[model samples]
Target chain A: MLDQAQPMDEHLGFEALYCAHSDAIYRFCLRLCGNPTLAEDLTQEVFVGALQGFHRLKNRSSAKTWLYRVALYRVRAHRSRHESRNVSLEGAAEPRSVSADAQYAMRLDLSQALATLSPAQREAFLLVKCQGLTCSEAASVLRIPVGTVKFRVHRAVNSLQSVLSDTPEASHEM
Target chain B: MRCSSVQRRLSTWANESHRPQEEHRVQVHLDSCEACRQYQSKVTRLDYLASEFKPVTLERDLLPNIERDGVRKGSGYVPRVFFARHWVAIGAAAVMILGATMSTRRGGAYSASAQEAVRGMESTELDRTAYHQSLWQAAGPHQEGQLELLDQVWYEAGKWREKSIPSFGGDRIFEFDKSSGLVRLSRDWRGKIISQEETSPRPKQIDLQEFCKQAGIEGAEANAEDLGTRTLNGVSVREISIPTYNLQRTLVWLIPGTNLPVRMERQNEQHGSWTTSWLFTIEYAKSWPPSIFDSSTLESTTGGPTARASQPFHDAESGTTNESRLSQRSKLPNRNQPAFRTGNIVFAAYLSTTKPGPIDSACASERVAAQLRRPLDSLASEYGTLQSYGSDSHDTDKDRAAGSKDQVYNLRFGNHPVRSVMSFTLGSDGVWKATSLKVASSATP
Candidate 1:
C-alpha cells in the first residue's frame, strides 16, 4: 500500500518537489492536453498555483493529488477560455518525427482514439489507466464520485477499443 | 449473471476492482459464454494498449520560470465560486474591448520602428550551428533570492541543447534531439551527475518568432514604443517598452543591425508597486566545440566530488556535547527575553520604529502579513519544515513619537534549512502595529 502521508514532506523544498513530481505532472498534463506546448503551459500554471496557495494546503500529505486537482482546474480553465476558438483535439495530435515502427503506430492510434473520448471520460481513463491512479484517487483529483470515475473509465476503454478496431491498419492484436 | 451484466462486470474484473464473488461469477460467465469472453479479451487488450501509451516530456524544466515570475494573475487564489460566477463574462468582454482597441490603434513612429526590427529578426536566418548564452536576474525589492540562473544553449538543425546553472541551486543540462523527439535532462550536484531522465519525443522547438507572437508583439497588439538607442557591451541597441495587460510591461533592447534582443525586462504592477520582475541578457556565439555537446565527454570532464555519506540532522544534534550546547544557548543575546534575534537588527529596528501615519494599521498589518506569507507559502509547497521559536518583546523609545508607547517582538520563523527573523511592533492599545521581516542567508551566518 502506498503511504497516504508521504506527498508533502515538511523537509522538502520547492526544488526538491519539482525534482520529484514534475515529470509525473508533466506526463499527466501531456496525456490530457495532447498538445505538448499546451501541456507544458498547463503544467507550469499548476506549479504557479501551487506556489500561491501553498500556505492554504490543509492536508500536506495529499500534495500529489492536490497538484493533479490544480492541473485539472487549469486544463478546464484553458479549455473554456479557448472553447470559442474551435480548437480540435485531433488537430492537436500532429505527427511527430518518430521511427515508423509497429509500437509507434499503435501509440499513434491510441493517441487518436484518446482524442475522440469525451473530456470527462478521457480524464478519468488517463488517471486510472494511463497514470495508474486508483478510482478513489481519480475521483479526488477530478472532484467526481468513485462510481462516476469507474463508469467514465469503462466508457473510455470501450470507445478506444472500438476506434482502434475500426482503423484501416488495425493489424495490432487489439 | 446475464450477458449484459457480465459484459459490464468484465471491465471491472479486467481493472481488478471486482470482489472475489464477482470475479468468480465473471470467470464462470466467461467460461460459459462466448460473447462475454470476446468482450473480456477486448477490454484486456484495451487495458494493455492504454498502459503502453507513453507521455511526452517537456523540452525544458519550467520550475525556474515559475520561481522567477512568481504567480500570474488568473492562477492566484480567487474564490472559485466568485470566479465561476463573474470571470467568464468579464474576461470575454475585456478581451473583445482590448482586441477592438488594439486593432484600431494607428502605429506610431516608435511602433513602426519596433515592427521593422521584429521583421528583421524574424527574417534573419539563424546559423545552423550556433551557441547562445543568457543571464537572467530579477530586479526589485523582492529579488528571487537563490533563483538567478545562467543558460548556455548550443543549437543545430533538429537538435537543441542547454545547460542552466543557478547561482545558489543545482545545475541542469537539457538536450532535445528533434529526430528522436527525446529530451534528456542531466541534473548535476557538486560537479557530479546526480541523476538523468530521458523523456518521450517532444517535436516542438522553441522558436523566437513563437515567443514574440506569444508576447503579443508580433502583429496583434503592437504597443511597443522605441526609446532611441543605448550602448550595451559596446553595441548600439534600440530600447522599446511594450505595454501589456494588467499594467505589465515588456522592455526589450534590440540590436538594430542584427535585430536580435540583447536584453529583455518584464515589469509588473504588483500590490500598487511596479517592479522589474524579470531581466534577461543574451549573448551569441558563432559556434561551440563539438565535444561540448557529447554526453560522455561532458560527464568525464565534470568529475564527481569525493563522496561523503550524509548524516541525519537528529544524529548530529544528539552527538553535540550538552555543555557546548548549553554554552551556545547562553551566548545568545536576549536569551531571557521573548523577542526574536534576527540577522539584520538594523533593518528590523528601522522598520519597527518607522510609523505609517496615514496608512491604516489594520490594512498595513494585512499587507505585511501577506508579504511575509509569500516566501513561507512557497516553502510550504516544497514541503519545507517550519520551526517557530517563541516570540520576545522589547520596549521602544517613547520620546521619539507622541503616540502611545510600543513594544516590539522579534519572532524566529524558519522553514528548516532556511530561516527568517521578523520584528513586529504593537502599540499600547494592541491595535496599531508594524512588521518587518528578512530571510536569513548563509552570508548572515
Candidate 2:
C-alpha cells in the first residue's frame, strides 16, 4: 500500500512504484528465487505487472496482497521451468560450478545445516523465521495448512538442533 | 509419543513462518518454558542464517511479458453475449418457462394467496442427438426402426406480485427403460424456491448412470424411510423426503390426482441436514398424442427396469408409480401439415436484450401465445424432440390450475414456449417445420 499508488493516472505511473516497494520486494524475491541474478530480473517484472493493470484497482490498501500474489505467481512459474538447481544459493548447497567461489566460501561458514532441509521446509523456514511472519501467515503465503507449516518448521528446528547438538539424524540414517 | 506431541508444540513454538495469532501464542509459550526456549533459540540461528544463504532478486525483464499478457487479455475483444447463442456454450441452454397464476388482489398485482402450487405443465428442451449417438453404441446394434426416448419435461412457473415469483428450474432425464428406475434429476421438483442469484438452474442432461458415477453415489435407491402421508399444499398426497443422500432425494406431493403433478419439492441435504429450498410443479397435462406412447418410441432394452426397487431402499416417494403403465415413450405428437394455410401458425423469438422485442410484450397477450407456437415447435423438432402440451394450454378438460395461458390456441400445433428462441427452421415434409413457420403481427386479442 502506498500514498503514491493513486490509480495510475499517468501511463508510466509504475516508475514511482519501482522506487517505492522495490527494495523490500526485491528482498522477498531474493529469498524466494534463491539467486541474485534471477531475483533482480523477477523484481522488475513484478513491478511492471502491477503498473500495467494499476487502473483497475479500486482501493490502494489492497496493494500489499496484490503485489504478494503476483510475486508468488512468478516464483511458482520460475520454479516450474528451472527443474535443475542452476543458481548458486548463498549457503544451501555446493553447486556443481560457479564463478563466485569466494562468495560460496563465505556462505558456507554461515550455516551448513540449512542445506539439509527439504525445499518445502526451507521455504517454510525462510518465510517464518527470516521474514518474521507468523506460521499462519507463512502458511497462507505458501498455500499450505497451518498444521503442515508447523510440522515442517518443527522438523527443520529438530534437525538444526541435531546438527548443532552433535546427535544428528543423518548420522543414524546414513 | 510424549516427545512427538510436544515436538508439534515445539514446532508450534519454533514456527517463525506464520505471523498470526499462533505466533503470538508460541512467543508466550517460549517465555515460560525452558525446554522450548533452548529449542526456539537454536531454531533462530539455524533458519536466520539459512534464509540469507540463497537471497536472490526478481529478474526485472519479465515485467514486460506480464504487462503484454495483461494488455493482450484486455484488448482481445469478445462480445459477452456472443457465445450465449451456442447451445454447448454453457450459457444458452434454457427452456422458456413462465406462468404461476397468483391469486391477485383487487389491483392486478401478484399476491400470495392460500393456494400457491405450480402444476401439470411439462416443458423441457432436449438435445436429442446425444441420446441417439450414445444409445447406438450402448444397445450394440438395432434395426432402423428401433427408437430410444430420453424424455425431459420442463414446467413453466408463474409470476407473483412481489416480483418474487418462485421460478421452478431444473432438468429431469427419465431414460425410457432403465432396470432400476434410474432417473437422473438436477434441481428436484416439489421443493421451495431458495436462491436469489440467477444461474442456469438447469444442468445439462447427462446420462443417469454417468451422472451417478460422477457424483460418486449409487443410483439404484435413495436412503430414506417413509415418514407417512400428510396433506401438502391442499393436495391430499404422499409426502416423501429423503435426508441421508448425496443429493436432494425427497419427493413432495409426487402423486398427481389430475394427469399433471400438483407440485414436487426438492429438499437438499448437506452435512446431515436438509433445507427445503427448491420447488417444481406440473399443473397442466392432457393425454399426449397417441403417438407419444407408441411402442416404436421405446428406447431401452425390453427387460430394463420398471417401477421395481433395483437397489437398496428406494425412496418411498416413488412407490406409487404404476409399473404396468411403463411405456418407454411419452412423446409429444408430430402432426402432418404440408403447406401454410389459414390455420398455419408461425413462432418467433427475441432475446431478453433484443430492444424490447415482440416476445417481451407477448407475455401480456393471449393472442400472441397462439401465433408463436408454430415456430417454437419447429425449433424443438429440429433437435428431434416431439412436442406435447396441446395447442390449448389446458390439454384436458379436467384441470384445477387456472391461467389464461392454458386457454390460448396453438393453431399451428407448436408446443414449446418462446423464451429465448434457440433456433428457427423449416420442415422438409410440411408446414410444421421450424424454418417454414412464419410470424406476422396480429391484431391484439
The TM-score measured for candidate 1 stands at 0.37
- Which residues of candidate 1, in runs, are more than 4 Å off? A1-11, A87-108, A166-174, B12-18, B71-445
DockQ of each: 0.12, 0.11
Best by TM-score: 1
Cα lDDT of model 2 by residue, B51-88, tens digit = 34423333343434545654666633211110010111
lDDT of 2 at B336: 18
Residues A2-72, candidate 1: write the lDDT tens digits. Answer: 01112333212455445545667888888876678888888887877776765555225466788889888
TM-score per candidate: 0.37, 0.29
Q: lDDT of each structure?
A: 0.43, 0.33
Best by lDDT: 1
